[model samples]
Target: MPPETPANFWGDMPEEEYYTSQGVKNTQSYFETPNGKLFTQSFLPLNQTVKATVYMTHGYGSDTGWLFQKICINFATWGYAVFAADLLGHGRSDGLRCYLGDMETIAGSSLSFFLHIRNSEPYKTLPAFLFGESMGGATAMLMYFQSPPDAWTGLIFSAPLFVMPENMKPSKVRLFMYGMLFGIADTWAAMPDNKMVGKAIKDPEKLKIIASNPRRYTGKPRVGTMRELARVCQYIQDSFEKVTAPFLTVHGTSDGVTCPTSSKLLYEKAASEDKCLKIYDGMYHSLIQGEPDENANLVLKDMREWIDERVERYGSKNL
Candidate 1:
């Protein structure tokens, strides 16, 4: 309720200036989807030829801003155009704060925007990659399942939530009790808070910065959110064989938020001919943003190399 001490994510610098300093052109806009008015941002290489387009999705309680932009900028600087949207109910998007009652509708909303951009001129023929981090990985997977065949050339996941660890799974009894309320408590922020940020970020300084995000949700999980995630994780696990796109899934062995078994499961079950998995020995869940510089860069380097190789193999001649 009080004034936020930090004016922006990166020191006192203006947003556009800071993005320019990072060697990427930044643009923010509101996208009107049938489900909600979504806050979206695009990061493009300043003067470099675009190699491909990367559509990104941030995790639960997170948005496309904050350190998430670091990933976007990194992709853009590597000659890719990156675009991201704040998932509904989080960040500047329209909805009850931090509530996710319907996972399909939420995934659909973001998918619409990504499809629009991917189908437009100068990009339609070019290779497009769908990238997701944390719970955003689940959203991205849903989007992929709902999309037309071949809609995305490839998929990249960082510490995705395709599998929920035993400790993090919501109690069935609790959900049943809440269900007795006839769905009235669906939007309530009453689910157990697993103190996920504490387990997801390894670097203490970076953790502080992530916690300072004004738009980040810092409340207990919503009833429907946990319920839907549990349900959807099972659904995605069952549908793993449906994945046919070239893909790379990465996880941290020490990640307490999402299980490293997530990546392993996907790699084993997916039908994709070209699938890769990377499990970092001691990295935390937020591989790209919460890790120390050398570590984050290490993850980023792997991501860049993976995407670059795919681009060369399947990329288009278009800008």
Candidate 2:
């Protein structure tokens, strides 16, 4: 079924169609990994010099397609070479849908793809940034920790799940039950009612489009996936002080999924001398895709200005 045309559609043309029409060079392929083949996408500017490279990842249950790709298209249009991969068990990637058993392995798979591109002759010298939204924000941090210092030129995060919101946190009883049943039914969908799809997005029309995404995982959070998510969020929260890369994190003040306090804590705790945090008043979790057109553009403008400044300061040195 076609997505219901929302009364509040943000773009004149559908986002994907608009991006293609704007002459962005978009490509989709799979990156071979030891565990499975990961679906990857790249968006590059057409007939323009690539100023910087952004390796990004989608939030939990989301992929590099649909509205998420709109940000990639915007980045490409602004002269960034954007690369992203669907994490294991998400989208077109080979794994159980939304079942992230071992986050380390999943993070490694994403980093491998980014490293492959970053090391290539054409992009080796470009200033590279790591971008992640929601849970992928934790994945980006994990990737940074796994890599040597200064590997990435900068980092960008949008409502990263460093700390799961209090209401969304799993109860002790649930965790105990998961522990008891994990070995036998680790893939079981444990939290069916925890769907944040409707809550995280503010616009009814945008919510309809997101819900209609063919690649989105609408099932309950798998047992192992939830466990790993808890563990990863805890790990990131504890390790915030270790971050040293220049980073800009933006969060909506009203986000109900991932707490806005997480970004605040990160800014206060992170060792990065150049780190920044922007809190959008009353915006929801989906800062760029779910907000109204004016609000989305407001966030995008901040992103563009930050990225362009970095490119101006650092890009020419590489060239």
Candidate 3:
């Protein structure tokens, strides 16, 4: 059974009480990477045997703090060690705010962090999994492609940006113009009408908390950032069949940011023999964070079951 919240707690428990109830040891710090210094947080089970390790990455303009940390806490309670890194330009990481200059550099920085933990003492022998949410999903997939086949035990994606939804996609003319203007003012914010936070989160209170996050980037998308995102999406789609790792992807049917068709396409085209896809009927993009309590719990239940089964079936004997 999962940890129970204290009676005094209301909508959300205090950080100390929450971590104590979950029996998790939490830590946060900054680490240097080739691209820039990155911030990372980890949640490890206390007085319990860890069954697996999950290296996570947050979505665009988001970080390891705020609602994203909630999922890490749950994983720790379930006997899994969770480590998450703030992508460059998000959270406390050093960079231009929400500006993704190059996909390769961004993905490479995460891969380096993950590999460090995977190859470290104690964790070196544990079965490892990659968990990516939203744009982080693209980086996770790219990391998988960059790694050898047996490097990770499994991959998990939540509302992955495999394909940008029609509503959220930028105009082709704008993209062309941006590409030409890349030589100058590449860092200028271009696409400003990003109402994704409103569309993605269903709970009004949680939406407020997310919106109030000081580190959250509410500015328009940058020219170089938008261009790179488009290129990355196209590359992932073209290389879907190249994904041979056992994996599972979950997306909400009502998601307005990333299309559900992306996960469907991955399921149909991926070469992985052991792969699964789950679509929550009316849920929004923020599966475990933005939904009502009941719906969020349901998504969390599915994710836990899927991950637990894999850990049991493929015990931490091989990498």
Candidate 4:
């Protein structure tokens, strides 16, 4: 469903750039979707001229800026302008704290953004590609499912979540706990020690940034959010064969947060004949953020090659 005008959506806060050195240009704008809800967005222009634009979405509990700076820098360096946004309720976007329940609505915001830009003068005809990480990857795929074939030139997913690892708890105990806790309190109750995607972050610098940012890395996932995440995982598991768009997915075997199995499942089941999956041997959940320099470089190398192949075959321009 299309939203009413998103006139109420807010833009990024003042200090987003203080947290990372990637130096995003900070267009710091909001587009009015329908329903008086506004969508938060940022555009980072590449220094070099470009043939395509990349629109990126970050993972759960992560803002677009927190997760996409490195990739944006790389894409910019490679001559592709990058556009990124916080999903509703994630970064600077409007809504409750982490309250996006439906993936379709989240996806629609991008479609709105794309249409809004496509109709504008500067970006009228530029080919745009979609990129997402983790839940953001799932959001991209969900959007692709809703969009027409020309909706995007192609897609790139990093650690896409077909199924995320919930916890190390035993199934019976975990379910019982969920049932008991959910039965008594609201079903949206957040568990302890479970929201720490950044707690054990290997990078001290990144952790400091996360710690410093009050708007980020501080959301408690509701039970509804957890349930929706599970539902989307199951949906992906059941409908991978329907995903026909050419996509490249990258994941790490050692990723304990989102789990590498999800990537394996997507690779094995996705219907796209042009799909490719590259698994990093020892990387963690955030492959681009957590991997060693060489492995991260290789991962980016694979993504670059794939993008080149798509642009060459598709012959689309970056906005």
User: Model 3 reaches what TM-score against the true structure?
Assistant: 0.93
- What CA RMSD would candidate 1 show? 1.6
How do the residues 189-308 of candidate 2 rate in per-residue lDDT, one tens digit apiece? 876457798879998888878887778888888777877888888999899989988899999998978999889999999998887899999999999889889999999999999988
Best by TM-score: 1
For all candidates in order, the CA lDDT equals 0.92, 0.87, 0.87, 0.68
Q: Estimate each model's TM-score.
A: 0.97, 0.93, 0.93, 0.80
Best by lDDT: 1
Looking at model 2, which ten-residue stretch has the lowest summed lDDT? 3-12
For each candidate in turn, give its C-alpha RMSD to the true structure in angstroms: 1.6, 3.1, 4.9, 7.1
Candidate 2 to truth, TM? 0.93
Tens digit of per-residue lDDT, candidate 3, span 1-319? 9554333223366766667776898888888997899899899988888888999999998988878988898889899999999998898988999889798888889889888988897888888999999999998998898886688989999999989777667677887777686557578887756778999998998887777776788889887788788889999999999988789999998997888988899999999999999999998999988999999999899999999999988888554
> For model 1, what is the error of residue 204's alpha carbon versus the real structure, in angstroms, after optimal superposition?
0.5
Model 1 score (lDDT)? 0.92
- Model 4, runs deviating above 4 Å: 1-25, 35-39, 44-47, 118-124, 166-189, 198-200, 317-319
TM-score of 4: 0.80
Tens-digit lDDT track of model 1 for 1-319: 9766675778888887898899999998999998889999999999999878999999999999888989999999999999899999999999998888888999899999999999998788889999999899999999999999888989999999998999889999999999999999999999889889999999999999999998889989999999999999999999999999999999999999999988999999999999999999999999988998999999999999999999999968343
The clash count of every prediction, one per candidate, is 0, 0, 0, 15
Residue pairs with colliding backbones in model 2 are none
